[model samples]
Target chain A: MLAHAIFFYIFSLIAIVSAIMVTVSKNTVHSVFFLILDFISISCLFIMIGAEFLGMIMLIIYVGAVAVLFLFVVMMLNVAQQKNQWFSARESSKHIPVGLIISTIIFFELIIVIGGWKYKPDLVSSMSLNIDSSISNTHAIGYVLYTDYIHIFQLSGMILLVAMIGAIVLTFRQRSGVKRQSYFSQISRERSDGVELIDVPSNKGVKSDD
Target chain B: MEYLSIIFSETYKILFLLVPVLVSVAMIVWLDRRIWAFVQKRQGPNVVGPFGLLQSLADALKYMFKEVIIPSSSNKVIFILAPIVTMTLALISWAVIPFSATQVLADINVGILYLFAVSSLGVYGIIMGGWASNSKYPFLGAIRSAAQMVSYEVSIGVIIINVLLCVGSLNLNDIVMAQESLWFVIPLFPMFVIFFISALAETNRPPFDLPEAEAELVAGYQTEYSGMMYAMFWLGEYANILLMCAMGSVLFLGGWLSPIDLFPFNVIPGAIWLILKILLLFILFALVKAIVPRYRYDQLMRLGWKIFLPLSLTWVVLTASFLFYFNLLPIN
Candidate 1:
């Protein structure tokens, strides 16, 4: 338990610091790197807490796919060299105080909620599907996911399918004047299409058609 | 005191596992070169040690002594961190790999998923390295890699789902144990082939190595990296290749289990069997690299999104339905 606590603290500290760095880093590329660090550290905490599946998923989804996309856009846009100034720009300076106030209120509200929250004495017992100690975390998740939460599971799959289609529809384009290989046309060509045998052409050579 | 002891033991286990892995990484590099050389009818690195066994060690020493170069316009911190990230992620994924029934570093429940996740995250190293280089070619390489990896991951995910459906467990050992009677490759040969090909693409091996296509991209993401930093990328690449081979063996080749349950075959230990399977897969990997031509960018994308996506998706459906019909699905 003590070791777990120590690891938890260490990971959480790294997560928090990196989370800050993600926002404050001057270089956009550096910010993305910091964001990745933030994700990794947080995932470490999750794994430490025995939610290994979720931790790994978070790493795969956020750090792997999403962050790479972010890095792609950042690099593609060529914004890494752009200097970031939080309050120096005159046009952006006016909203700073208001943003600060709103953020502080939200932070305080989160703190209050966390401080006031408490687990009920019977909460563990009242759960619909308790985590089975005998089975591994993946098995437990599979059991619940396929049985009790089947509808939600299927629904999430549908959502992902919709998202994939939408992305393709949005970005897919066909342009004119660009050559593309047509396997059908290429394969369908016959010798008669290009080759012609003429009896009189033996000595006179082939006549050019313009 | 108990916590201290546990920490000590864990550290000891990590050291025990890591040293062998590090050594194997070196050996795998040398072997890969030799294999590639043999395929091309050339004698590979024969001067270092017997059969050039010490070539990788010599290369490592040279890299260590070389000067570390950082581009003036590059983001120094990230430029350095990228290779470290790549190397660390490559090594860390081994934590959940079960060598045998009882031998494992960390036998977490979500072992396969953890592997999937870590391997997926391997893209960031390339992207960061390329972006931090602040050059056109490297940036282009990074973007291509990002798209390539992401596209391939979709099919890989579905393929894994097909396996998970049959085995009904994400734990690596459980998956291996489920194959006691019949290995998955015999039944799911198409998926095995697709998975192997996708693993090749995922690791940026030859044929699918568009990210570092020398004729065009000039070493791609490692364009600006030098010395130890460059060496780190090479190490990470080989480690990832090994990981993929291990994954292929575990998922399809019945892992550490002997080919048959008969007298002579079952005499060998499970760990040795696993190692043999990994080596076999590695040889296949090298053979493919030597034989196949590099794919064009558009064709690569088409293969990943069009061919593999539909094929793997259909396989998942077919596997699920077949398992259901035959009552072969493992009931958890």
Candidate 2:
């Protein structure tokens, strides 16, 4: 129990610091790297808390995929060259009051939720999908995810699909006079398309441009 | 006293595993060169020891004595940290890879997932190394690797899903035991093949080694690295290769399980069989390096996204349906 507490403190501290660094870091690449670090520490905490499946999946999706894309974009766009000024942008400062108000509201709401929450007397019995201690958490989550909440689960998948298609649609374009290789057409060509037994072909090059 | 003993025991176990892995990494380096040489009809590292056995060791010593020149314009901290991260992450995945039914470091329940997570994180090393070098070639190499890994990782995930459907459990032990009747390679042959190719791309082996295309990018991310740091990258690369081979053997080839049930074949220890399977897969990896030509950048992307992705996704659907309709899926 002491060890667990110690580790929880360590990981939570790292996560908090990295989360701050993600916003405050001067270099855009460093910010993305900090974001990655934040994800890792949170996942470590999750793993420490016995949610190994969640932890690993979070690592795979957030750190492995999302943060990588973030880094790729940050690196590719050369965003590190532009200095980030949180408070110095006079025009952007107009939005600061609104942001602070919204943040404080969210913070108060979190405090209320954490401090005022309590377990119902029959909370264990009320849950339709109870976690069984005998089985691993992975199995328990799989059992519930596939059977009990399959629709909501698939709804989220659909949302992701829509987002992906939207991104592609936003960026995809066809340009005129820009020759693109059709691999299928190039591959499926026949010998007849390349060679012909014309009598006058040898002398005139068979009007090769045609 | 009790905690101290536990710590000591764990450290001892770690060393027991680490020593052999380091030794094997050295041997695999030697083996890789020899295979390449055999394919080319030339001698490889034959002057060091018998059949060039100690050549890797000699190379290690040379690296140790050499000066590590950090580029003046580089981000010195991250530049030095990259290879260490690479080497550490490479070896870290081995903790979950079971050697036999009973022998493993962690033997965690989500072992395969753990492996997946670690392998996916391997890209950071290259990206960091490339970016920190403050050089154009390393940066380009890093960008190529980042994109290549991400693309190939998608197909790899889908392929693993096919295996997971058959096994029903995420545990490595369960996966091996689920293959007691037959190796997965026989039934999921297409997936196994696609998985191997993706593994090659994942580990950045030749044919897909665009990240380090010597003719184009001057060794890519390692362009600025030298001496022990460079050796670390090399060691880590081979270690990652071994890990991928280990994964292949475990998932498809019935890891540590004797192929035949007869007395002679079955008498062999499971660890030895596991090692043999890894070597066999490694040889295939090396043969691929020798025979295949490197892919164009666009072609590599096309292969990963256009071909492997759809093919692996279709295989996943087929595997899941076959198992579902026939009630052949393992029930844990």
Candidate 3:
């Protein structure tokens, strides 16, 4: 238990530090790397807390796919060296109070949730699913996800599908006057499509349009 | 004191797993080259050490002594970290791999997910290496590799879902054990083929190796690396290849199980069968490298997104429905 506590402290410390570094790093690429480090440390903490499935999925989804895309965009736009001076930019001042208020609200909401958990333990336990100790972490989660939370789980999936379709509809466009390779047409062309046989052309040495 | 001893024992076991893997990495490089040479009708590395078996070893030594020339304009930290990251991530995924019924480094419950996670993160190394070099070719190579890996990873994930559906467990050992009666290769043949190709794309092996294509990008993301650093990339690439082969064996080829249930075949240790399967897959990988031409970038993208994605997704639906209909899912 002591060792677990020590390791948790270490991972959380790294996560916090890297989370800060993600915002503070001047280079966009470095920021993305720091964000990845943050995700990794958080996932490690999740694994340490016996949520191995969630932890691995977090790493796969965030570090593997999303973070790579982040790096891809940051690298492609050649914005790695761009200085992040949010406060100094004159136009940015317009959004500062709004950002602060939103963040403050989120922070307060989290505090309230924690406070409620401590003060009203029964209330917190009311919604919690029964975790079977005999089953593995993955099996337990599967039971809960597929049974108790199936509707909400499927609703989230539907939301994601809608978002994806909306994104595609927003961005997809067709351009005219572009010569594109039609794979079907290219592959299906036969000898009959382009060849002609003439009988009397042999005597006149195949004269042009005669 | 007990904790200290436990840590030491864990380290010992880790060395046991890792040393063999690293050594095999070297041996497989030689094997890959020899296969390529044989396919082209030539003797490969015959003069080195009994059929040039020591060639890769010698190459490693040479790389050790050579100068690691980091480019002046490159991001030194990331440039160096990239190869280490690549090599480590490639090796780390092996922790969950079961050599036999009882032999594994870490028997985590979500073993397949851990492997999937680690393999997916492999792109970071190449992307970091490519971007940190701050050169046109390397940067372009990194971009190409990033897109290629991401695209194929989608299909790979769905295809893995098919296998998972059949096995009904994410545990690598359990997945292998589920194949006691019949190997998944017999039933999930199409998914296996798609997976094999995606594994090629995932590892950036030839035909799908647009990221480091020599003719166009001049070694691509590896353009700026030199000496041991370059060797690190090669080591990581080969290790990743081995990981894919291991995954293929685990998911489809029944892992360490003997092909025949009879006495003679079952007498051999499970690890040997596992290694033989990996070697067979590796040989196919090498054969493809020797036989097939490199894919164009657009065509490769089309293959991954248009063809493999739909095909694998449909296979997942079919597999799930069939399993549901036949009551064939393994109960973990």
DockQ (CA atoms), all models: 0.76, 0.83, 0.90
lDDT of 3 by residue, B40-61 (tens): 9998877789989999999999
* Tens digit per residue, CA lDDT, model 2, A1-210: 777798899999999999999878788888888899999999999999899999999999998999889988888886654444534556777777998999999999998776655534465477665687899999888888998899999999999999999999999998889988799899999999977786775556656655
lDDT of 1 by residue, B1-332 (tens): 88779889999999998888889999999888889999999998889989899999999999999999999998787789889989998999988888888899988778888889989989988987987787989988888898999999989999999999998878999999999999999999999999999999999998999999999999999999999999999999999999999999999999999999999999889988988999999999998988899998998999999899999999999998999999988885
lDDT minimum window of 10 residues, candidate 3 chain A: A80-89
- Candidate 2 per-residue C-alpha lDDT over B164-198 given as tens digits, one digit per residue, 9 for 90 to 100: 99998889988888888899999999989999999
In terms of DockQ, the best-performing candidate is 3
Q: Judged by DockQ cut-offs, is candidate 3 incorrect, acceptable, medium or high? A: high
TM-score-better candidate, 1 vs 3: 3
Give residue B319's error in model 3 in angstroms: 1.6
Count: clashes, candidate 3: 0
Candidate 2 overall Cα lDDT vs. reference?
0.92
Tens digits of per-residue lDDT, candidate 1, A1-210, equal 666687888999999999899878777777887898899999998888778888888988898788888877876775744444434556776777898999999999998766655445465577777778887676778789988999999999999999999999999999999999876798999999988787775568767686
